[model samples]
Target: MPALDKIRWENYARNLAKGMTQADAYEDAGFTRSKQAASALANNPVILQRVEELRTERERILSGPTVFDEDADTDNGEPLVEVTMEWVIERLAANVVSAQSTGNHSAANKALEMLGHHLGLSFSDKKAPSGDEGKPGSNLGSGNTFNILSLTEGLKQHAAALEQMPMKDVTPEDDG
Candidate 1:
């Protein structure tokens, strides 16, 4: 039941800038008044704007420029699209964390949506796992997800792409 308050989001993004996982950010925020922190931060519009600015900037640096619209056709003040690698890395690693306490599909979906928005792209979880076994899910060998296996050709097409990725950026889990 973690609530996203302005201060908490700012703090979380700050920690993320320091390479902390989202789960750790949830538990490790230095909140002197945890109960009222959300309300307090919400009242300060400046802080909220700052949070969005910083987060969006970091998100831009995480993903490649091809994802953005070079034309900037419609709005003069429109910001560039950004794809933060933090969420993807966390989701991918969560698969190996047996005792993981903080993770959810909703959060994962939001991350992917945010990334797509930054890329001016749209992607559905066509391979998202289901209880029914027959339904197709992301298979590493089959190359369903836009992950390492699928990106191999693209990586070879452009050698520079492999160098720009964020730390520990890898393929996410099949279920997410």
Candidate 2:
């Protein structure tokens, strides 16, 4: 129950994120056998519950962030700090599609979860997106179907997932 240092990991965490297993991230982050000892804590219910509180605080700090808003004009436009589930998916899609080169949904979703962290959205990559999230003039693609995003992330995530998916599953279907 100790307090998190709030240590600014900066880009350090991102570097370790090049398609790492949750196990890898847990170790690389320097927790000492804690992920194993506190496996339940790994998916901490309390942490998830306080997400809204943390998010609001994060927004307050990032309100005037140094990163320039690409879709904004200096005087008229407001910074669109989009924190949508769909946007999170799109962001993670890069890795998802790459990992899914051989075709897999599970791998793509894992990629999405990791990438979602970077995008300030905590979501599972497995959960497919629904309607009404797409923006005006935006073609965010349909479902978890074979889209560029999922396809790409799948390629990266497949390094782990493929190892998990047994070779027997890849056999050509028997046509009876």
Candidate 3:
């Protein structure tokens, strides 16, 4: 019936914006206990407006910046800001330097070999994909009867259904 205090409403709005329940926000705002009172305060027009504003502000902050453009092949021939070849090389060099400083030749060599796969400087540790088609060794081995992604998804659903089925009950006479 009456408007909530400005400070309490603001506190309630902030908590509500963070996905807290209305009742929780009401109590957390430091208001006196009473479900009916809390409910009435939460439903007040001014409190509702504050909650909306806080929610909008939160949405804006979460969606702002820190987004990657996956469609673009490269950042105009420039190395990516994160995970660039130069970055990897720099890290490997740093590892070697750190190892050498501690008189750990093994560690230094290990760092060098870390990037060996990409640079072809050392033997690859990856298992070479066998030329077998539809076999266990390959991605879609002999067991995989269907190659279509949609069909594969259906097979997964079927497997899930099989797992959900109750086990068959057996009696001693039935077993015999």
Which of 1 and 2 is the better model by TM-score? 1
lDDT of 1 by residue, 110-155 (tens): 5444534444444444543555446554332233345433333432
**Runs in model 3 lying further than 4 Å from the true structure:** 1-5, 66-176
Instruction: Report, for all candidates in order, the number of backbone clashes.
Output: 1, 23, 4
lDDT of 3 by residue, 1-176 (tens): 12235667777766776788777877898886667887787788777776776666556544643233243232121122335575566556555555766789999767755644344333333343665545453553333333234433533454465457443433236554
Candidate 1 clashes: the total is 1
Task: Point out the higher-scoring one by TM-score: 1 or 3.
Answer: 3
Question: What is the alpha-carbon lDDT of model 2 when measured against the actual structure?
Answer: 0.44
Ranking by TM-score: 3, 1, 2
Residue-level lDDT of model 2, residues 77-139, one tens digit each, is 224454666545444554465556657778866776576455444332342345545554234
Q: Where is the poorest 10-residue window by lDDT in model 3? A: 71-80
Angstrom error of the Cα, residue 176, model 2: value is: 86
Top of the candidates by lDDT:
3
Can you tell me which runs of candidate 1 are displaced by over 4 Å?
A: 1-27, 65-176
lDDT of each: 0.45, 0.44, 0.56
